[model samples]
Target: MYVTEYPKGDVDKEIDKLNKKLSRSFSKDATQVIRKLQKANCDALGIGRHLIAFYPNTWKEKDKNEYLRNVKFKTNVDVEIVQVGIAE
Candidate 1:
């Protein structure tokens, strides 16, 4: 995600730290949601459709009803803070 922050602080070090924290927070939140969906066997992201389209052989080997439960998802969120004003 692109985060444009007009931070009140002028310290570059502090801003970088804040950016890292924000990134981690976002990543954690997203991962939790994915885990919940996986546990419920809910393929809300249409992953199965993509698999059928791109990986037909791999898709055919899995049980259609249990595919979501068997899938492992790793979520990564990258946040870039675009500083607008003058900061070093």
Candidate 2:
């Protein structure tokens, strides 16, 4: 996933738009994949071993934090901030 904003229009608006997209892209289908695997697991589901690589955009510090927080707090997955911005 990539979060980015060019130097045009309103940055906040762009960030908000990106946030909305981010929230929707990684959906319940992802969870389902894990669930199916767990159904066959002999022991622990061990979803915590999986990494949900999250790379949300830059500040709107509050919004960015909230987005990442929701992903981390709401899910059993461990998310890693792999990168910020599209490039550089």
Candidate 3:
């Protein structure tokens, strides 16, 4: 997922817009996927891991979840469909 934003906008509003966009894009199976990931205690987004990689010292001093809670994420996904079969 990738996000491009206007240089000057309300940060929280921009984040909300991005979240809504992502939710719409992944609406079909998003709930189920979220439930499964939460149940498994998995961070499929790699957010924690990425933070650790980029800010090892800071990560080592703080809880990953706490850090995650303070960070904002924006994502974009592209979907392509190909080869629809004839109905029986």
Candidate 4:
């Protein structure tokens, strides 16, 4: 349910906006999980993969950091509260 924009503006600004959007969309627990996931440098959202897949020739020749530094991300989360169980 996430939507990302490649705005015609500064990359850092875009990333900052994206971070704020994602943080607001997720719960505190979910935010912590995302931070942990990011700690491993895992682009679970497939952004890096998409770039590599669509731009293979260019990707092969370019520095990954250069590409990643300019990349922006936005994430949305839907959490369903499945059960409110009795305390055991």
Candidate 5:
């Protein structure tokens, strides 16, 4: 599921500069993005068991791990981070 706050044209490309296949979506900000993904997983409409998130290369490792742990706790799904090398 996509959960970034970036503009439509910039979302996927921002994370996959090499034009690789990556699963993502755009939202309004960092906070709402995670909430939406969690909601999607529990909603009537079924979503996938895996989620892919994009992060900037400059992100602190601790923060990254924390976010991953939080997502799993909330959604109980697999979370993967894709590095864009640039902060959002």
Candidate 6:
């Protein structure tokens, strides 16, 4: 994480809050990307591979190539600010 100005109050707490907000933003973006991919019937994430390997019966029940569109995706993102770069 890089900041032009250091947080004015409670540096640690502010960084933590920023991290949470960033995580949520990233997760939302990921979900949007996933939806776009599913709409195009593009399994760029290889979700089908996991389903076929572990849940063969479930995979068999859906249309082989068109199943992703109907699948539900739960996305979680965690962000960590390992190094905070402050410009001089």
Q: Which candidate number maximizes TM-score?
A: 6
lDDT against true structure, model 4: 0.56
Predicted structure with the largest lDDT when compared to the true one: 6
Instruction: Report the candidate with higher TM-score, 4 versus 5.
Output: 4
> Which scores better on TM-score, 1 or 3?
1
Score residue 61 of candidate 6 by CA lDDT. Answer: 88
Flag regions of model 2 displaced more than 4 Å.
Answer: 1-12, 42-84
Off by over 4 Å in 1: 1-13, 83-88
**TM-score between candidate 4 and the true structure:** 0.39
In candidate 1, position 75 carries an lDDT of 80
Per-structure clash totals for the candidates:
0, 0, 0, 0, 4, 0
Compared with the true structure, all predictions reach lDDT values of 0.79, 0.42, 0.58, 0.56, 0.39, 0.82
Q: How do the candidates rank by lDDT, highest first?
A: 6, 1, 3, 4, 2, 5
lDDT of 5 by residue, 1-46 (tens): 3444555566554554322333222212434666666554442222
**Candidate 4: tens digits of C-alpha lDDT, residues 12-78:** 4455555566556685666566566566656676766886889788778766654454444444564
Q: What lDDT would candidate 5 get against the real structure?
A: 0.39
Can you tell me which runs of candidate 6 are displaced by over 4 Å? 1-13, 86-88
Q: Give the TM-score of candidate 5.
A: 0.18
| Candidate 3 residue-wise lDDT at 47 | 66
* Model 1: residue 84 alpha-carbon error in angstroms: 6.1
Decoy 2 TM-score against native = 0.33
Query: Which residue pairs clash within candidate 5?
Result: 2-24, 2-25, 4-27, 5-27
lDDT comparison, 1 vs 5, better candidate: 1
Residue 21, model 5, lDDT: 31
lDDT of 6 by residue, 1-88 (tens): 5544665665465888878888999999999999999999999998889989999998888898788898899998888776665566
**lDDT tens digits, residues 1-88, model 1?**
3434446565455667767887899889999999899888899999999999999999999899989887777887876666545434
Sorted by TM-score, highest first, which candidate order results?
6, 1, 3, 4, 2, 5
**On a 0 to 100 scale, what is the lDDT of residue 22 in model 6?**
84
**Which candidate would rank higher by TM-score, 2 or 4?**
4
Stretches of candidate 4 off by over 4 Å are 1-46, 58-62
lDDT (10s digit) by residue, model 2, range 5-84: 45655544566565555555555555665455545542143323232223222332334223322332233332333334
Candidates in order, TM-scores: namely: 0.75, 0.33, 0.41, 0.39, 0.18, 0.76
